[model samples]
Target: MTMLPIQTTATAPVATPVATSTGDPALPLELLELELSLDGFSGDEASFAEAVRQAADQVGGDFLFDLPASGLAEDCLRIAALRVPKGENGAPTIVFALLDAEGATIRVENPDETTKDLKRFADAFVDVLQRI
Candidate 1:
């Protein structure tokens, strides 16, 4: 299966630590999220997410695979910002999520309110697949 690249003129994704009141804080969740309506893809949403998880791992990405029995759809993938190095900007990149299907969406830990980061990520992921 070939995936077509999508171009977006949006801002970049940034990661920030989530404030915690307790001693043990949960993992940081992405701040910026973008929705995508893709064409020419028909499959189960969970399967799509698993494929992404595998692809990300193949590309040396720090990804968290979703549990098959979790029955969760939104936070399916938690990955590192590939284009941007982790802890490059002083703050550690938080775990990000990507959900793809006929309609897809990407979530990242960024303060910017633009789709640029998501666009870059999507492009990068496609580029990796093309190379492999």
Candidate 2:
């Protein structure tokens, strides 16, 4: 399997703020900040699951696919997994999703502690998003 390298920067946090497309100017506009890494699987849920497993191994982090609570399904338009490693200060949890036939998206949550390494992880996630 081919893997891509992601790098994060301190100046810019790994977040993509998207606005809702609802055309209600009077209502408060909501913004969602998503920090994700993305890749392409073989357009199959099973393939995506395997990719997540490999990514976990490569990152030395625990991997989970189609977590029940995540509401991912084979028939759904898209599906993904949020991989959370073990230990108190382990790697940030990542959410890997199949955006479409040609691409997948991985989102990473902030670590419990605000450390430089965590920041780098966030940056890496951002880099992944950009590449995707």
Candidate 3:
């Protein structure tokens, strides 16, 4: 697995779980910040699910990919994740997707690594919307 390293000033506090956590693994990362928006995602439920998955594919370090909920627009996309402190060479245990954001499905598996990729994924998602 490719390890994406995020440049940072200090390590962020281990994030709290959003939905039900697989297991509360410690995710100590710096307080990184990034924002993305759909602007106007005039699409059906299936499109929404696909778009969310595509965005997640860009941001690596994923530990789990649960079955998509029946209704995406009505369901909060949740991705459980975890990694050993050493690196990808480490095992993928399990953690919570607890970052609080509005109108965005987010789960930073490894805060130190996935920050940049998440931003890239967000940009790509917007591009996907514009193309549609």
Candidate 4:
């Protein structure tokens, strides 16, 4: 199995503007989380990385970096990218870069997939965000 790098920095975290959702406490962040599942590939790591780059571009974010796992379970992969706009409180977040080798599945831990199949993951992510 191949491994990708994980990148996390200690830059000053920004606080986003408060946005109301369902009359609850306004989410003070302009964050958009998206997850996408891809199948029917040969499981090429390079291709996967490229796909990630493309996704980041589509979301107008830069390829901040990725982190690879260690030990016997090296097949599990995670990557993260970011997009920050001037005067914005927090950086745009894209995460949970998960790739499942056996299932040939690439799961993005974002919360913006509006498709029926991925609604569950999106909802779960939003729930976590609310609690944070």
| Every model: Cα RMSD to truth | 14.2, 15.7, 13.7, 15.8
What is the full ranking by TM-score, best candidate first? 4, 2, 1, 3
Tens-digit lDDT string for candidate 1 (1-132):
122334533242222223221322332221211111111223345455654444345433544333331223333432323322233343423233434222233333331223345436555665676699
* Model 4 bad stretches (over 4 Å): 1-33, 37-43, 71-75, 78-91, 110-132
Alpha-carbon lDDT, every model? 0.34, 0.37, 0.32, 0.40
Clashes of each: 3, 4, 5, 11
Ten residues in sequence with the least summed lDDT for candidate 2? 24-33
Across residues 1-132, which tens digit of lDDT does each residue of candidate 2 receive?
122334545543332322112332221111111222223233344465566556556655444334321223232334434444433465444433333332333333222232234335545765676698
Candidate 3 error regions (>4 Å): 1-19, 25-42, 61-132
Q: Name the regions of candidate 1 deviating beyond 4 angstroms.
A: 1-42, 65-92, 100-132
Q: Judged by lDDT relative to the true structure, which candidate is superior, 1 or 4?
A: 4
Roughly what TM-score does model 2 have, to 2 decimal places? 0.33
lDDT per residue (tens digit) for residues 1-92 in model 4: 12233342334222122222233242222223223213223354556666655655655555455445332123555433333221264444
Q: Give residue 32's lDDT in candidate 1 (0 to 100).
A: 15
Better of 2 and 4 by lDDT: 4
- Model 4 poorest 10 in a row by lDDT: 12-21
Candidates 1 and 3 compared: the better one by lDDT is 1
